[model samples]
Target: MAILSPRRRRSTALTVAAVAGATAAGVCLAVGSASAGTISGPLYRDPSSAVVRWVAANPGDSRAAVIRDKIASQPQARWFANFNISTAQSEAAAYVGAANAAQQIPVLSVYQITNRDCGGASAGGAPDLNQYQTWVSNFSRGLGNQTVIIILETDSLALLTCLNSNEINARNQAISTATRTIKSANPNAKVYLDAGHSTWNSANETANRLRAAGVQYADGFFSNVSNYNSTSSEANFGRAVISALNGMGLSGKRQVIDTSRNGGASGDWCGDDNTDRRIGMYPTTNTGDSNIDAYLWVKPPGEADGCRYTAGSFQPDLAYSLANGVPNPPTTAPPTTAPPTTAPPTTAPPTTAPPTTAPPTTAPPTTAPPTTPPPTGNGCSASVAVNQWNGGFTASVTVTAGSAAINGWTVTITLPSGAAVTGVWNAQASGTSGTVRYTNVGYNGRVGAGQSTNFGFQGTGTGPSTASCAAS
Candidate 1:
């Protein structure tokens, strides 16, 4: 998100004599004070919002609730719930309904249409395009003008060894068909084509796939849907892809990249265990570029794609361990330390008599001086805090500004060596090489002074850590 300039106010009353008197009297008056600010409640910050409340009330697994809360508490963050078609459909309906009730726009992932696992790890989608279209229609029906962001399918465009040309074409066709159907159903909805991040697909290759997949029919393309690449690299790569798409007659088309998981880019095809890739970029508003729309968080924090041993199961203990930077169930030993000692003292001095001098001839009572207000905490300030869980880590942040209520603010998180971002929300992020820049979208307005807004991201990494956040 870009920053807006502050407006200047014109002064009305300015008397030289009054100014002199106030200065001479050493009085201070308040001026340029920021307006009242607000700190969003933890509950309000949850990305899942009312969806979590409803899910909590009607519970099965509390893990979902924990994940939802983590997402909501920050500025740019999101959660990914990988379920079978039946479950995905049901959850999609519930989320849409909840979003409607709260009058809040929600982001939803359409995960069950193709070979969902990219031919590995998890179960695949429908066997054919016809069946996939039906599923797409079903998902669309549930969304009734409720704002939603759809991360179509993950890694579908990936050129895998097992995926033959025919199979790939069939999958790409299904994506194109689904996009067309969804847009026709709900014109207001925002759709993003999953481009498999910078690591999987090169700029030219990804653009061709997007074109073949009929990207023009949708809002734009989506990159890094579920991978762990940083936002900066992704943004640069995405810009390249968008340029390619534009060259292919899809220019001026907007695209969104998932920042949820890629605070840092991976060094190899399969993520390494010795990296500290984490960032604090958030989603941003429409940039008015046809090639890019917004960077978004489409993955949830703390949800494991699959364990080091097991493929795709939710391991809470592992999740917590990774998020908090502990080695599994942490040891119980305390460190040894030395005890403290004593200190020294000092002496006193004598007092002097008060001076009795007639006060200078009373000038007209001096006026008070103008007050110097505290620094404005509101209008566009950001910070990034990183935490480790299981084998992965996440970054939390807050962005604030005066009276200019931030719909959201975008910041880029530079990850430490050997780290990879795995998830994010409230913003769209893209990058590689241990750096992710998050840009906020759907920003409402002026975030008043003194108030701070929060956002976060999650990723996988290894070893000693360091992270930083800055406006993009």
Candidate 2:
């Protein structure tokens, strides 16, 4: 997400100790008045965040209690995305040093670009490549062996299509230069290129942009940075991108997803109210996927998404609703675990390392090999169709429930040799290089007699001509 601090009217609050001492069921009760303390990682907490200032200024406001308990209490990323080059070094040094002293890993969201946000709310960025390089060098200097996760530019990947060839080439060069510079200055620092969100770009398309922008030099790419997509959707998106990247020879890379403010309905990202959004899976490195490194609080909760107040301002009413609207895990759930000293993969390393260049994007294979018909009377059937382009394809699956209603169903298919399922929607899924499985989620699980439900996924491969389906 774009992180711009707009000029806003200030409100007047209680002492930090008083806010810390205030208690609610799921709110954290850390020694400091701020800090939700729900994360199981040593993510740095900015002592001077807008939320903290808001809480201190207006403790007597009706929404103060919930705002303090929810927004201020959680550990979120500190964005150094502004083009304030004059004092950028000192600011980075101070933030890095503070986290180092506190023995925490600082998660930084870096957003300086030549053309940021495409003339939108977060429109300003470095005037040219030289400024960006200078800024990146200064930003990199702060990483003196202290662990840092640099979230490189939010709209970098998704915005490539908007630029002409010259701009695209320049953007890619700047990104490549930045990746090399950061790693050269601090090899220990983890760098993640931003790949927008699931709903914005297909995994195949994002992977292509990320590869062109030098994702190979970085740790991996990040997703759901400023949006409110579901955890599984982002997870699937990452998987697909990683798989496609691997096909491009960037194997063993990883991904991290932003879970902050995704725990609720996650319907219309622009329209969803604060009450509809909850703090998603707590910050942790144990994100159930071998390819995914962490679920982070990238977009700090309570910060307006340009819709409510000016973008990035902390609103008390929004904060209160995000805290009290839905049930989050109690603050007692692991007060604060340190981030991993080494980047740990949640699962075993991938076994397949295929050619990096995807086959030419073209129409699907003309014919399918004849196969046995699906068993009848079991009340289920599966049909698969594929549409392919250079390096990637979208596979659609239609599951027809036969004569009777089924409580739940699972569709399993073998991917074409080099293909990998990167993103899936309308269902939950899991798999390996050759096989993938899709199961119904709550809203779409039950299938009435003779009815069907359609689910589709994007992947990197040529074709999966046919798939076998079974049901009980």
lDDT (Cα, tens digit) per residue for candidate 2, span 116-179: 6444345566988899999898878867775678888776666442356898889998998999
lDDT of 1 by residue, 1-472 (tens): 0000000000011111111111111111111211111101111123233323333444455444333333323223222323344543455566666555655455665655555433322435576667777777776776676456666665455323234588777777888888877777777677777565554446787788878877888777776554444555556667788788878888665556655434432121111121222322333332223344554555443333321322222334333322333111112111111111121101000000000100000010011111223234334655543333335433445454534444555565667787765444434568633667666544312234545433444455631233233332
Which ranges in model 2 have alpha carbons more than 4 Å from their true place?
Answer: 1-41, 266-268, 271-275, 328-472
All candidates' TM-scores? 0.50, 0.63
TM-score of 1: 0.50
The lDDT of each candidate is 0.43, 0.61
* Winner by TM-score: 2
